[model samples]
Target: MRRDQSPFLLANPRRVHAAPWETREPDQAVTVVGDFDTALTEVELHGRWDPHLKASAAHVLRTCLVGQPAGIIADLHDLADPGGESAPLWCAAHTWGAHTPSLVPVVVCLPTAAPLAALITCRAARWNLPVYASLPEARAALRSRAPRTDRLTLHLAPDIDALPLVTQTIGEACAAWHMLTLHRTACAVLTELVANAIEHAGTRIDVAVTRRPSGLHLAVQDHDPRLPHLAGAVPGDPGDSERHGYGLRLVHTSVTAWGALPTRTGKIVWAVLTAKSAGERNRRRPSTIPGTTAPRRS
Candidate 1:
């Protein structure tokens, strides 16, 4: 969790985006742009609404929220009304945001003159999230509102022997930042992420943690461009209760926010956890070096 020395002189934590938005497929309906630290999901809602479209869009938006704390943008430029099944799908998107851990879904209704723009606005209002009429305004608002904090990155190989070192390093960093309360959650998250990489991806991993203004941002990177997605539950399925695919689910329940995104080389999965409380922060802020105390002011 140590900061890598910058080659340049000035170091600004707010300017660091460890994972920027880069997409492999140019034709995807839902595109995720950004990394664990900050991201924007642009979804183009065109064509006739079908069950396949609904499922696909839902899956994409879920993955976007899972990889990054930010929400997705529903682009309604080519439609007069969502009509048919897509309207309900939009409601489902809003419901997903409400149930998922993070900001509500954002909509970009371009040109202001699109026939269904006003209808889209009304629909999004019912979901309680704003609909922007311009792309620049939407991007500007989302970018400026993303978490701005210092980030520390670590690189490790795909070996089980390295887990201990990774855990200890994360614990030390959390303690140093008065975030000792997050040590357990951080350890669990890091372990699950690294283990997944070692078993499935079998590639070197890059782990980064950013201490945000109010919480912690943890991202795990591996050389697998395929995004991790949740499997649908089957009725009366024994595997539903089994722990095979429960690692990320545990993460989803433990943290305040979590998401995943595709990197140029691989994929980065990230989560945001609540930091120590005011009282705990106060207690840990002073008392360093075992017995040292701050000098009293006159």
Candidate 2:
């Protein structure tokens, strides 16, 4: 994949015409572009939002929400929904986001004059979806309502050297956020994730560390669609590859919860390390990993 000129573009390679977080239809009737600025993920919708675009748009929103961004700003200024038929979509999205363990905030942005503005306010009123006239206003409102989070991101090559860099970054983030207790586990989880990508994916990687109120969030994204799964190895047995299920096994034991999500270009393996009690951690685990089906070879 060729790199684009978007400032947000990192090591994770994407299509020449689209950013890693962007999705569009062939006819270009609708486009969903997501931008992650450490603190939040901004999803901008362009073109018509009629029935034809509803399914694609919902998928994009679900993908963004699954990544557990601290907050979301859904920009709909350019989306035309004259009849407000898309109001239900926004309502469902907000409901879904709120139900996440993190309770990720999802806000909408559109000019007051836009046809969808009044409809969203009236139809989505029960969901209490915040609607803003501008991005700045929406961002400010979300920042005020959402929990404060700190984040660090690094774009690295798929090499063994990236391990130390990722460890160093995680150490710094944990220290800076006063999460020294989680530093070791955080580093262990992140390094294993990056190392797995380096060995199997052999593509550029984007590593991100986010400090949330509950714990540390670590994610490693690579340009390979193959999802990681726990090898069906008997306990106390180190499978054939020497390091075979070792990395993911360590990650599974060290983190409170871990899973993978497919991206436009590849996949992101993420884990959360928390100091909470085991009971609380159990409550945080999702019934199933998002974007994951039965395990399969790449």
**Whole-model Cα lDDT of every candidate shown, in order:** 0.56, 0.65
lDDT of 1 by residue, 50-153 (tens): 55445655666555554334556677665334343355556666667656544445555455655455555566656555567776677677777655545677
Model 2 off-target regions past 4 Å? 1-67, 72-103, 107-119, 124-126, 130-148, 234-243, 277-298
lDDT of 1 at 108: 52
Judging by TM-score against the true structure, name the best candidate: 2
What's the count of clashing pairs in each model shown?
7, 0
The C-alpha local distance difference test score for the whole of candidate 1 amounts to 0.56
Per-model TM-score on C-alpha atoms: 0.51, 0.58
RMSD of candidates 1 onward, in order: 13.5, 9.5
What is the Å distance of residue 81 in model 2 from its true position? 12
Candidate 2 residue lDDT tens string, 162-221: 677787887789778888767655666677788788889999999889876687778788
Task: Give residue 262's error in model 1 in angstroms.
Answer: 4.1
Which prediction has the highest lDDT against the true structure?
Answer: 2
